[model samples]
Target chain A: MSPFLRATLTIAAKDLRSEFRTKEAFNASLSFSVVILVLFSFAFDPTSEQMQAISGGLLWLVFSFASALSLNRSFARELQNDCLDALVSAPIPVAAIFLGKALANYFLLILVEITALAVFALFYDTHFAAQLWPILLVIALGTWGMTVIGTTFSALTVNLRMREVMLPTLVYPMLVPALMAAMTLTTDLMNGIPLGGDNLLWLRVLTGFDFIYTLLAMVFIDIVVVG
Target chain B: MRDRIMYVLATLSAALLTWNLYKIFMILPDEKNQGAIYRIVYMHVPSIFTGFTGFFVALAASALYLITKDLKYDAFAAAVTEVSLAFASIVLATGMIWGRIIWGIWWAWDARLTTMLVCWLIYFGYVMLRRAIDEPTQRARLSAVVSVFGCVDIMIVYKSIEWWRTQHPAPVLSVRDGGGMGPGMESPIYWNWLAFMCLASILVMVRMRQESISREIDSLRRMAHAY
Candidate 1:
């Protein structure tokens, strides 16, 4: 494997190992997503016709909020012992470090999204299994999009005074188009809309967004991380 | 010489905007379909035009700062972003007024309006990010990263109408698709675009001066602490 890929995997493994062992942020974000899923039913009648139409929006909203909650912790742990500075000064490439952490974030967020989807299915009686491949496709694309921007901005605001507040404030707006695409696609999937033809446009948009942002984040991550 | 140019830009924009206002209100007649409500286009279109211009400029300035490691470019980027945010606010306010009158709604979740608002929020978050960081180099580096990252939305905002073509009108300014205005009515929008640019230049100049002074103060405090 290329050194860059190796470095990224190593960092991602380190993060996943540490996170899985303690499950501090993982458990918090998972619970956050599940709780929001349950609370959403109270916010609106989940059995209503309108609720069926908007279930996708509600699910993605929970995923985004919970992901932002966890992404902020990606770098917060490094700050514990001035570990961020030490990591930056190490011999590994800066972009690799960003990718590794983003990869780890992607995995954690995916797990949260899957659990959230299961709870949503159980509560709302939505039939996602019939469109399992399409739904998973949307989730994978959308979650990667959110994880990329979230991880980069997590590093961006990690050194700030009000990072707890700043991270979501910054991440949420940037998350819109990706999250919107995700929400729209998810809604259509839940409502039994076909995934190709005219829907091809949204798929293109989601894919394009994921590609462009990942490249931009990688190019700029060095300045944010190493500076 | 710089001061002279500022004066010239300020005087020209003020005069042109006055003439433009009169022309829009007095010279131009109401549209057959929308009547007086359409006049808000003069403000709404130009404000968003200038706002987009400022965002791209900030993007470039941020890229330049990253390449040169120059504090001046960072400050320039910050000033342009903040001033452009003011222009973006005008766009939202005027667009809402026009929408309320023409479409009978204050806002719509249509692609264009929502993406425009997303751009506004992203940049506002940019300003908030800058305020949270105290270290000069770190602030410059990190915020420049974000300035570039946030600009990805501007592209999405620009294409949203073409992409979704829902409630928002198509490219009226460019005569694309079935979406052009009466031949001469659009002249005012183009001229006002220039006027808003001049206005933005004046504000950016004033803001950049403040940014420079703040940088100096920041350095002085650092020096004092060192001593």
Candidate 2:
């Protein structure tokens, strides 16, 4: 492997190991998802058909909020012992560090999204077992888009006094396009519609968003992470 | 000498806008279908375009700031963003008024309108991000990253929202589409667009001057404290 890839992997592995030891972000995000799910159920109290109509929006809403929470923690960890400064001072390229942290966030958020999906299925009394692949595809692509922007902004606001407040303000608006695509795709998949025409357009949008934001974040992260 | 140029440009833009307003209210024949309601389009379309132009300038200045590490570009970015926010507000307010009259509602999730609001939100985030950071160079660097991201994200938003609007149909005014305006209406629209762009240019220069003066004072204060 190239040195950059190796450095990226090492940083990702380090985050994964540290997260496994404490599960702080994981635990916080999961519980936040549960709370959001419960609140949504109370707010809507939808009948089964109504649930079917709106569950896609509700599911993505929960994940977007939870992703913000976890991404904030992921970067906050770096600030704990001036570890970010130490990492920056090291020989690793800054892009590698960005990819590493974003990769770890991607994995963590995906796991939380899966858990949210299961809980949503149970609460809304809906089943997605048949449309599993398409649903997962939407979730993965959407989560990656969210993580890329979220991770970058989390680092951007890491040193701020109001960072926790700042992260979501920056991340949420940026993620709106991708989340809208994911929601629409989820709704269509639930309706058992094949991907064509409008559905394909949305899928293309989600893919394009993922590609552009990842590339932009990679290019911009060095500016943000370094002095 | 530069001040005289700005004064001349400002006076010219003012004269052009006054003339355009007269043409909109009196000279242009009202649309057969909507009558006077179509008049707001003169302000609405131009505001949106000028706001977009301001954002594009900020995006370019931000990129230059990052590349050159020059504070001048940062000042330019900040100035353009502040002016753009004013233009964006005008766009939203006029849009809401037009919607009320045309669509019989205060607001609807019309794709263009929704995307414009999101654009405003993203720039609002950009402004807040700068205020939250205190260090000069770091603030410049991070805000530049956001300005670039904002520029790219708006295009994605325009695409995604356009597709979403098609799938979920809503009552659109269709004023700009099939109901083609004659030269009488089109002339005022273009003229006002030019006026708004000129006004936007003058405001950006004024704001840029203010930003640099404030920055100079900050550095001078630091120098005095060192003595």
Best by TM-score: 1
On the 0 to 100 scale, the lDDT of residue B90 in model 2 is: 95
CAPRI-style quality class for the chain A–B interface of candidate 1 = high
Q: Compared with the true structure, what per-residue lDDT tens digits does model 1 show for residues B11-101? A: 9999999999999988999898998888889998888889889999999998899899888898899999999999999999998988888
Comparing to the true complex, what docking class would candidate 2 get?
medium
Tell me the DockQ of each model, to 2 decimals. Answer: 0.87, 0.76
Candidate 1: Cα lDDT at A191: 87
Q: Which ten residues in a row have the lowest lDDT in candidate 1 chain B?
A: B170-179
Which one is best on DockQ? Answer: 1
Could you give the DockQ of candidate 1?
A: 0.87
List the candidate 2 regions with Cα displacement exceeding 4 Å: B157-162, B166-179
What clash pairs does model 2 have?
A: none
> How does model 2 do on interface RMSD, in angstroms?
1.0
lDDT of 2 by residue, A1-227 (tens): 99999999999999999998999889999999999989887787656577787778888999998888889887778887899899999899999999999999998899888988898888777767788898899999999999999988988898899998999898888888888889988987876776688888889889989999999989888888885
How accurate locally, in lDDT, is each candidate?
0.88, 0.85
Cα error, candidate 2, residue A195 (Å): 2.8
